[model samples]
Target chain A: MQLKNIFQEGAIAAHFIAESIAKHATKTEIGGHNIFLGQVRADDIDGKKVTAIEYTSHVDMALEKMHEIREAIFAKYPLTCMHVHHSLGVIKAGEICLFVFTSSKHRKAAIDACAECVERIKAELPIWGKEIFEGDGYQWKVNN
Target chain B: MSIEIIFFGQLADKTGCSNVVVDNPGSIDALSMVMKMQYPNLATAKFVIAVNNKIVFDNEPIEENAKLAFMPPFSGG
Candidate 1:
């Protein structure tokens, strides 16, 4: 399986997601597929609402870490395939920023692997996000 | 010995520049000390140090010409 770079310049579009799913239809052994999408929320901070999120990363390190995460997940789970994508530039509120797709021969492995992939990506990746408020003010996002 | 320092995320903004070269080559702690003095705002900022793309603790010794990255807490989803 070839691992993609995973970083897109903007939001991950619906057509891209559809095409990803379409690619897997030929694999007859796969019984289940699970997906996780992370959308930019319009959070209200200090009476101001967030307009968008500008993402940046230590690109080389992030890709390296993601590759490690993928390898670990594949080793631990009985999965047929997995894909991860994240947006790098400004993504407006309500747009998708992150996507994780996992397929397995059984439902449990697909579901469990997809969730674990999302959690690991959030904790292990070297990506940063700035919340751009409506009036041009911004704050750094901290993941809880 | 000189080392290359790269800052990411909010730390880069606080430092006002993304990359710099420092003459002091020692442990990560020593580099932090120099950075704190040069960029006072970084003194209060929270971050982690990575040597050659791998995260390392403050006590980790930095080799000459090493590529060090200062990264803030990750917020990616």
Candidate 2:
């Protein structure tokens, strides 16, 4: 079976998030929803300002790892649904690079699951970002 | 005994190429030695080795046509 791919080519659109939330309306069992958006930050380094971030990943490994994470979160939380989308290629500062949404019968489960999912995605996914500076320089971004 | 080694993230930058096919060097330690010799710049880089998508630490014997991946610290969200 094919695993669900969470990658998008560029910046995630706001309407995509809206549509995702809208789609969950029919699922009456879910009483609470939590969302997390990761925006590309224009960080200044050594007098250079970051203008964008170009993301890349090992597709096969990332999907496999994501599947494992998805299963684990379901096993641990009473979540009704979970969705993750991360952007590849260049995403300008102030644009959304990641969107994580979780739904549950209670507020706490969705809230906690969303948080944990974000943390794990940052720490575990086999993805990298190249920070493009405003002028001509670039550097690999490291998560803190 | 051909083993494919794939490089990811900063390790790819250090290696200049993403993937290399090498003669199987018997064990993980031997493969590391061979890789360091072939790509001297990789000697100073920090990375973890994964065999067939699973991270491995022990000097396990590698079978023919195994896929190896060298990954640097993950920085994705």
Candidate 3:
């Protein structure tokens, strides 16, 4: 399954996506839920203050990559369910930008699956965001 | 000619726009056109183009209507 646009107003919280995912997985007898949320910070870059961010993506590619991540995680981890969400366009500092949630019969499997899914997204996804500094400069961050 | 071009990160900053179409037929290659008009400084920069989100380099054929996304090296967490 895929989520089209995940948000609650200006918020990018993972809980919304997790709730939706839970609703979609009624047959899943999960006992643990592991969630990771990525937030934007006012990072300082070479005297520039990053106040916000501008995001862009190859939408079709990003979706495809996300699907691949889900499939890969399922193959490696015995998870009951998984969900991934990302923010496009501009996300202000203190705003949630990305979320990955995994549920399983055991905590270890949930945690492991969550980690792997997020890692794959960072490595293969074609989404990009530019951190808007306080000054006239910006920086791009990926999961390094 | 129909060409799909995508932008990302700093290159998007330089381009002041996201993806765009060329529209008219041209002899210049897609990458060359992007390099020439979009981010000329990238002429020597390390980067890659994702044809339908798969990264490939050197003589990657540009189909009539394939979605192409361009990116520079990335650093994140």
Q: lDDT by residue for model 2 over A9-51, one digit each (tens)? A: 9999999999999999899999999999999999999999999
Ranking by TM-score: 2, 1, 3
Per-residue alpha-carbon lDDT of candidate 1 for residues B23-55, written as tens digits (9 for 90 to 100): 965787778899999999999999998888899
On a 0 to 1 TM-score scale, where does candidate 1 land against the true structure? 0.96
lDDT of each: 0.92, 0.93, 0.69
Error at A135, model 3, angstroms? 5.3
State how far residue A28 of model 3 sits from its true place (Å): 7.1
| Model 3 steric clash pairs | A49-A133, A49-A134, A50-A133, A142-B75, A142-B76, A143-B76, A143-B77, A144-B76
Indicate the TM-score of model 3: 0.78
Task: Candidate 2: list runs displaced more than 4 Å.
Answer: none
lDDT of 3 by residue, A4-79 (tens): 4422224475567656666845755778888888888887767777888776666676676667777788999998
lDDT of 2 at B16: 94
**Leading candidate by TM-score:** 2
Q: Per-residue lDDT for A1-144 in model 1, tens only?
A: 354598999999999999999999899999999999999999999899999999999888888889999989999999999999999999999999999999999999999999999999899899999999997789999998
Indicate the docking level reached by candidate 2.
high
Q: Deviation in angstroms for A91 in model 3?
A: 1.7
